[model samples]
Every structure is written in structure tokens, then in C-alpha cells.
Target: MATKSLKAKGNELAESNKQLDILNGGIFAEGELPFFKDKINEIGHFPLRPKKLEILQINVGYMCNQVCEHCHVDAGPDRKEIMTRETMAQCIEIIRNTGAHTLDLTGGAPEMNPDFRWFVEEAAKAGIKDFIVRSNLTIIRANKKYYDLPDFFKKHNVHVISSMPHYTRGKTDKQRGDGVFDKSIKALQELNARGYGMPDSSLRLDLVYNPSGAYLPGDQMALEADFKKALKEDFDIQFHNLFAITNLPIARFLDYLIASENYEDYMYSLVEAYNPAAVENVMCTNTISISWDGWIYDCDFNQMLDLKVASKVKHIKDYNEDLLNDRNIIISQHCYGCTAGAGSSCQGTVA
Candidate 1:
């Protein structure tokens, strides 16, 4: 794992505005690729607006155990930002009444938050149909205190969506960190022992496979098949599904693209694979992303870029879904990532 986040290293890319400048100033400024708004406008979809809310994707903190090279959150042990119980209380209040059906909890590793369990236990009571906890897997083995995480999740029926990167140890460890593969395998087994990912269980245990590098993921079903075969044969591990997500160019990923001189080519790839149908179901249209400090955004990507919602309601403390639903979704070059190919969202492909 990287010893420090770009923010801790004082890398300019840590600044959302700096990253936005690069995203907005590059080949985009020279018309090498159409600006995201123009691309959307070609289909009469400019000024992207929200639809009926369906998911509440909340970032409880940025503190995480690993520093994956492609991490858009730039989360790591070095990150100190965390959500306080007070902010979480506000979230629970909204959760108890929101019309949204899915409640997604994310972070550097949301488990790192001091009040993570308290928040989960409270939110679970809201009776949301799909309760998700985006776990990093290794965190379940990082410390003894976390050993019971699988049991806790099973008790609450929290849908465990873990980041596996690849089915092979080499690719998995390379993208996340050394020893991550072994630990993740163990964690998956433990989750299995608790009935997660088991074919006969209702406990949903899904693995997320984002490309280890600057490339779009292949077919989700094919990748899921390969992962199932490799994992079941190699480790007797089982997961219900695999979500193949496109790596949006932002945060550490954008840094990698720029440092490796693949930014332009990657942008070209995204533009070439742009699927107009994908734009209609982008996460921004149905989800509201809340930051660690309670600020609201159109989506997690926009949250990282510090793009607050274009509405009167701007924070969780002041959440007004009706007003929030009536706003334009922000767009920029990075928007291409979510609209490319089959289209990527938190729930995997849309088209």
C-alpha cells in the first residue's frame, strides 16, 4: 500500500480544483474530445437532471486501510477525515423517512470510522430494501476487532460488496497491496462460513472488479464467470455476483493517468466507447452522495471533485429530497468514464 495519500504527500492532484483544471484543460480544451455537456447534448440530454431518488450513497469517511493505485478517494491510513456520530444521526434521521430504497455506505474503508457499527445498526432499522456496505475485504483481517464483521453483517443482512480487483492473486495484490489477496481470500471464506455468497443464502456477497490499470473492464457476465471458476476451483470461495466498474479518471487514478502519460489515450478510449444509452441511467440521476462532513453531491465522483449539488439543499443536515431532485447534474470530462461502453454505476452496468 502507498504509505501516504496524495493529500498527505501534498500532491496537487489531492486538490479537487487542481484535478478539475487538468480534466477541463487538457485535450478537452483543444477539442480532441467533446466536452461532456456537448456529448450529452447531442442526444438532447444536456443539463442532466435527477430522476426519482433510488439510492443514498453516503461517504462516512475517507480513512481507509489500503491505498489502491486507482483509488478515486485517495483514502489510506494517512487520511484523518471521519464522520462524527452527530452527522450520522442526521443521516439516520433521513434514512428513517427517505423514499430511496438502497442505502450505500462507503469510505476509505467505512469500517475505519469509530461510529461505523452504530451508524449501521441504526440505519438497518430504517428497513431500506437494499442495505450495502462497501467493504475492502482485507479490513476484515486487518485487526482482531474486525474479525466479527462478517457475523455483524450477516445479522443485519448488509449486502457485502467487496473490492477484489481480480480473481488472481497477482493482479489483486498488485492493484490493492501485497498480502491483500491472501487476506481477502480468508475474508471471503469467513463470509462464506457465515452464509454470505453462498448459492443457497439470501445474504448477498458480491465482488467488485475494477480494472487494475487504465482500461475498461470486459463484459461483466464473462468476468463474473471467470472469477467464479477461478475462485471456486482455487480457493472454494463463492460470491453471488461480480460488478465490473469502469475507473473514472479522477483523484489517484487521474494522477496515474497523467504520470503514465495515458491520460489522452484513456480519454480517447472513453469517448470512443461512449454509449448514449448509458447516459440515461447514470448514478447521478438516481443517487444522492453525501460527503463525510455532510455535503451533498450528484454522485461519488462529483463528491471527490468537491462538486456540491446544484440545488438549494446542500448538506445532509438540510436534506430536502424534493428540492434536491429538482437540480441539474454537474458534468465535466471525467463524466465520460461513467457513460462509456455499457455504462458504469455503483450497481454495475446500466445498458
Candidate 2:
């Protein structure tokens, strides 16, 4: 009976996805992050100071199995863009020269890239202190080739950060497509078996949560407890940590806001909750995002909006730490998502 229900739900989702593709014209469109806009206007123009670049996040490709409703990357299986070996080589050279402590790999599914493992293996050889793979979870179980990713990550001691939109199947499926929740859970259990979430285990597996609707996420610590309890009770899964991320208003999510008529209300919420302290620790101050094509941006959200870094060095081949640090962060309404409440960043709450 459960199997039948799951199959029926999957079929329904397939039909919904087809309709979404039509509504989006096969390409995700931009929507408003009202709060970001209001904050930008109120704060006026302030120059961003470059602290030492500690983490370099590289986008390997835009190919993904599922097109979620709130995706900021607007990535899908149809996306043909993938990073070339030449660009990867350039990034490696930058890593060698820059002495950045961490390398964060992200994508529609970073594992989908042919060079994904190669990049990880090579980067591991570089002796970087931390390696992180931002996975969508479902990809680990979606293909035979990727099934061994947990072991691969274990071999490299890679810190795995994966998305699981909600603890409940209903909400998670609604946001990420049907069967995603089940696959994600199975993948998590596999990671746990390899000592990912266990105490004293070197393998770290963290789950990422973003609200399915237009509202901001509740308290991070509190939400983590709920997730930990739910996943443990229902699926016998364990993870090292839970990161609550606010969905930035850009890309597919922005399109949802415009389509659902929630754009103004969502923006107002962000602006109203703005805390000045959040601005000081915004992730862009400490991190830089590299697109699949090798263009640099202040952060990943900025990258999707085609907002290039304000620095003279805009690409990896000619990465200039001094110039990038001296440049101002490109400001827009979308930024409010990062600065609201306790603040949110790729690594979770900034404040």
C-alpha cells in the first residue's frame, strides 16, 4: 500500500513538473527579494572591505536531476554548461598560490560532472585543510556511477553538506519533486553507516534546510533539533549538523514569488527584520564564488543574478586577491535574504 501511494505521488509530481517547465518557458526567471531592496536603499551605498579569502566555492556545472520550485541556480538536466578542464586547471593553480584553507564544490549536482571526482582527488592532493561538497542528496542514489560517493567522500574526509528541504515527505516532495525525500534519507543513512554523523567520526554530514514557502526560516538551533528528532525517529538517520539557509530572492525562486504574488510581502519581511550585525558577517566578506565558466562573483547568489565581482580581476585565471578585497560588494534587494534576522549564509547563520 505504501509503495502504491509513493508511486502515485511520483506520477503526480512528474505531471506537475511538466507544467512548471511550460510556465517557466524552460528557463527560470527572476523575481523580487523586496527586503533586500529596502535594506539597500536604507543603508545606501557602502563599500565592502576584503577580509582574507578563506573559502573558494567553485560551481562545476549546472546539470541537475530535479528542477525545484525555489532553486536560485535555475539548474536542470537540460543545462548544457559544464566547466572545462582548462578552467579547472586554472582554479587549481589559484588554490596553490592563494593558500585558501577550504574548497567548496557546488552545482546542480556536483557529482554529475565527469570531472567531479577528478577535481576532488586532485584538490585533496593539494593538502587543503577542508573540502566540502554541496550535494542535493538524491544524486547520490540516482545513478549507479554515483552510488559510491559516500565512500569517495569518506576517503577524502570531505565535509558533505546536502539539501533536505524539510523533514516531512509531503513538504520535501512538494519542493524538490517526488521520491527525493526517500532517496535523500537513504543517502543519509549510507553516510551515517560510514561514520558521517557519529560522534568522534571524522566524516561530517550536515543537512541544509530552506523554507518551502516564501517565509523566512525559524531559529536555526531550534529547527536543527526538530530535524534531528524527526529524521532519527522516522528513518533512523543521523547527521553532524543542520544548516538553516534563507532562500535568496533570485532565479527560479524569484519567479515563484512573482507568479504567486508573494514578492512584496516576502521582501517587506526581510527588510523589517534587518539586523546591522548581520551585515558585518555576511558570507561574501569571507568567500568568493566561481561560476562553471570561471567568472568570479562576491558570492553564489550574486553569481546567479549575473552580478560579477566589482574587482578588476573577474576571472579565475587572473585572480587578484588584493583587487578583489578592495572592491565593493554588488548590492541589490536580494541581499536582504542574507542580512535578515540572525542572518543566513552558505555556512548557516552568520551572526
Candidate 3:
């Protein structure tokens, strides 16, 4: 959790990125917003860098079943971008050669990718210790073909982390879409029937709790208790753990914040809640994000912002372990989300 002072040069670059403004839906220009950089200056350490990478988190595609209001990926059923088998082969090679123990797969709905199963099978054979699948829940119940996903995930021992904004249908459906909560519950039940989330089962099923509005998430353990109690008492659902994720200011969520006139307040909240201890364990330090087109990024939020890694090996095809390891991560104001409060990442709070 140690950090050097936020140098003048680093602050200048982080707050001056024109690309960041464009990527953030043009709500406000970088440096124009005074929250993130000012807070970092107070805390010391403006632009963060990578540590020894141990996780390869890849976004396989942009096609999703539901277009949620808060979806940072902006994924929808009409989106056609997906990772091909060729790209999967290259990614698998990188995972193998880089000695990354975890292969994290995500997407509009990762299962919606045609080569998802193929990639998982290949990575599993390559000795990946942990395979994390970020699912949208409804996709598993969206079609007959996807119905077998729970069993397939169980077979590969893939850790299932799905988005469930709230335990109540009102809050869940409000953020996602109508009927989403019902479908998600159905899917969770299906997963439970197959040993996932069960105490004695090796299969793990974790639920993600995204803030329903432009706000930071609550305590992870406390929220998990709330979700477990509500779901179990209301619908008899069960899960292993809960990940409380702070919604990054980007994409659809960014647009929502601006529209609702809460953008500045939310950014201030993130800056004020800054936790330096969380910086050391930020997902980017240990994880490398791969976009569907094979581009490399520091994290999924960075990927969404088109903040390509500062490394020369910025694509999966190139896959340079040393250059990536030595390079500084591309940072912007959006990084506040990852360093705020307990700090948000793909695995929930870092602190």
C-alpha cells in the first residue's frame, strides 16, 4: 500500500488526456473535472503501474442478451463483435507462455461468443488454475443452447461471477431490465441445483452487486449478508459470495450520471473515499485485460475507455511478457473508481 508522491509530470498527463474525454462520452474534458487528479495529488501517486501479472482477463465479445442501463460495455443483442477462434488461440498461447494462473473471460455475455466453450476448453487444458466467467445470468436462461452452461461451468470448475444488482426485483430490474430479476433468480436456482454455491461443492457461484445508481458500493460482507438473507428468505436462492463493485464513470453509466446531474457528485464521492491501501491490489497490477479484437489494456474499465496498455506489447498477438511487465499502466480520472473506498475490481473490494 506504499506510494510515492504524485509527481507533477504524472498528474499533467493523467488529467490532460484528450482521448479520455472522448472515451468518457464527452461529458467533461480531462483536467476540466477537478476531482480525481486533485485527490490523487493529496494522496500521492497519480498514475499507477503494473506489478507481476498473474491474471489474464479477456473480453471475448460485445454481444449481450440484455442492454442494461448501467452496462459499461454497452453490450446488446444486436452487437456483432465477437472473438474468433484465431484470436482465442493467440490468447491461449499468451496465457500458457505468461504463466498466468487465472484466465478471466467476460463479454456482452461471454457465452454468447461462438468460441467461448472452445476457449475455455483450451485454457483448461493449458493448466489454468482458475477460470473466472463473468456472466449476465439471463443469458444462461435465454436459450436452450445456453441452458447447459451451469453444468458446463461445473465440469471445467470455472468460478461463476454474475451481475445481480440487487436481491429485490424492483431494484434489480430497474438497473438491468424488466423481467431480468426473475430470469436471474431462475438461473441462480439452476446453478444451485447443480452444486454451485453449495457448501460442500467445489463449484463456486459468486454474485456481483453493482451500485444501482451513481454511487459507491457498500461493505462487501454486509451486502453479501443482505443479498443472501433476502434471496434465501424470499426465493430460497443461495450463493457462495458477493462482490460489491463500484460503477466506474464510463459508457452508459457515465451518460446516466450526466443526464441525472449526479456526475460531479459521484466523482467527488470516489475521490473523497480514496483508499491508498487498495492501490497495491488494484486488479490491473496483477491482471492484463484483452479486448475482443486482441488489444491489451490495464483493466476492463480501461479497455472500455480504449486506454490501451502503455506497453509495446499492446496486443495478444504480440504477447511480450517483459515489456508488459516493465511498462507503466495508462491512468486517467476514471481510475478513481478502482481506488475509491474499499476499492472496486473484478473481484470486489481490494482493501
Candidate 4:
């Protein structure tokens, strides 16, 4: 009887998710209201404190193939926002001056940008120690022009990190879209064939995972093991480390919480699980997020919310490392998601 009841609940949840997909029109659909309101209230407003900007993360555009349910960026196919070459030039100038070790490029699909390859080559020429691109694998297979991205990435020795919500096709498709899983799988195989994620390949390939619901993610290490085992067994896929990120309570996710009547409960979950220690390793402390328009933020999550770094230097041209380093990290209810459990960040758990 208990097992039957559990199954019933699961079925109900799945049905609800299907309805949501239809209502919102995609997997990572946009939601109304801010998901981190309570957490923000609890934590109060705080400024961002930069710790020697080792990384310069740039948002090349806001266009994407899939709109996942939990996407804070709210990026989608219809988004018209794309970073201009002029902006890229400014970013390059900063790279030359700051000597930041890593240049992390992101977008609806960074590869979709006309100047993406150009930027990669330029950054590489600057002798940046690490060049990271956050890709949504399907884009690599969406067009013939993008077919050679894996090769180009390998040639430049760019570290590739991609979003793969689940190992199973059903869940992946449900979160991304129909046919997305197949393409992502093919893309991963291509990358793997090019020495990525291989035993000793220097061309690194990492996968990212976020929960499919309002709840925080489970153990990162354990989830990674499951993904590794399932992908390898099911599709003969191989990859390096898996990054388990918690879904921030903002954008479409926040909309889902309110629509599903789970907003309060979700907030309670994060608050109850908050670990002070997690704050010490919050990604914002170590990383700086740059918007396509040149606005700077404590981290990517803040950028999505239009929460700029609490410093006089909000844009790249006016970047003041000392002032940013001395400011306090901006805190809000959304932070609980990062501080919960083992903690979560773009790189995975903070703890």
C-alpha cells in the first residue's frame, strides 16, 4: 500500500510537470515573481567583495535552444540580446590588463555568436591560463556550422563544461526538450572521441547537473557517480568530473514555485538547511560575473536578477579591483540555495 501511494504521488508530480511544460511552452520555462524574496529578506542587503578577480566570466548572448524550467538567465530561442563585437573588444582589453587566469564564456549558446570563435582565439592569444566555455550541447548539433566546435575547442585547449540534467533520456528530454537528449549524447560522444574526459586527456570536459524541481540538489559526489555510471553504461558516454549545482530561486523557477504553491515550502527548506560555513566558499567571493552589456555582479545568479556589484565600478571599463575586493558580498534569500546541504555554485558544492 505504501509503495502504491508513493507511485501515485510520483505519477501526479509527473502529470503536473507535463501541464507546466504546456503552459510555459518549454522545459526550463520562465516563472513569475522572484524566488529568493524571503531569503533576501532574512539575509538583508550586502555588497559584493571581490577576492582578486581570478576569473572573468562574460555573457556573450542571451539566446538559447532550450529553456529549462529552472533557468535563471531566462535565455531562450526568441531572445534577441547578443553581445556586440565592440563589447568583446572592451572585454579583451580588460583581459590584457587584469591578467585574470580564466576567461569563462557563456551565453544562450556561446557558439551561436558570430564572433565566438574569434573571441576564443583572441583570449587564447592573450595567454590566459584557462579558457572555459559553458555550452548547452544541443547547440553544437543544431547546425552544421557549429559541428566543428569540439575540434576548435580541442585545438585551443578550451575547457568545456556543459549542462546535462540527467543521464536518462526521459528526464533529460523532460527538462530540456524532446530530441535534446539524443543530440546532447551525440555531442558528448564527439567530445569524448576527441580525447575529452578520457583517462589522461588534457582537453577537459565536465558536465553540470541541477535538480528538476523546487527542492535543493542531493549530494554532489553521489549524484556525479550515478551520472557517470548511467551514462557510461547506457550510452558508452564518458566525461570528467560532474558539477552538481543547486537551482537558484529566481526567474522561471520562482514563477514555478508560486504557480505550484511550493514557494513558501521551498524557501523554508533552504533556510532550515543554511550552513554558515557555506558562505565562506560562495562562488561570488572568488569569481566575478560580467554581463553582456559590461555590468559586473558578484556572481552569475546576481547578474540574472540585475543585482550589480555594490561598488562604484559596475562596468568593465571602470572596473576597480581594490574597491570590489573590499566590498561585502551581496546577500539575499536566494543565497540559501548556495549554502544548503554541501552548498552549490557554478563549480558545484561550496563545502
lDDT per residue for candidate 2 within 1-351, as digits (tens), equals 011221123532223333333333322234333324344446643665557888899999878887788877777776767888888988887777675788899987888888888888888887788899999999989989888999999998899999988999999999988898899989999899989988678887888999998999999999999999999999988888888999876767776776788876877787778877888788988899999999999888878767789878998877877777788787666777888899998899998
Clashing pairs in 2: 31-254, 34-267, 35-267, 36-333, 37-333
Please identify which of the two predictions, 2 or 3, would achieve the higher TM-score against the true structure.
3
Residue 107 in model 2: shift from native, Å?
0.6
Runs of candidate 3 with Cα error greater than 4 angstroms are: 1-19, 22-47
TM-score of each: 0.99, 0.88, 0.90, 0.86
lDDT of 4 by residue, 211-239 (tens): 87878888888988999999999989899
Residue 322, candidate 4: Cα error in Å is: 2.5
lDDT of every predicted structure (CA atoms): 0.93, 0.80, 0.81, 0.77
Report the C-alpha displacement of residue 40, candidate 2, in angstroms. 6.3
Off by over 4 Å in 2: 1-45
Candidate 1 lDDT: 0.93
Give the candidate order by descending lDDT.
1, 3, 2, 4
- Model 4, stretches more than 4 Å misplaced? 1-48
lDDT of 4 at 5: 18
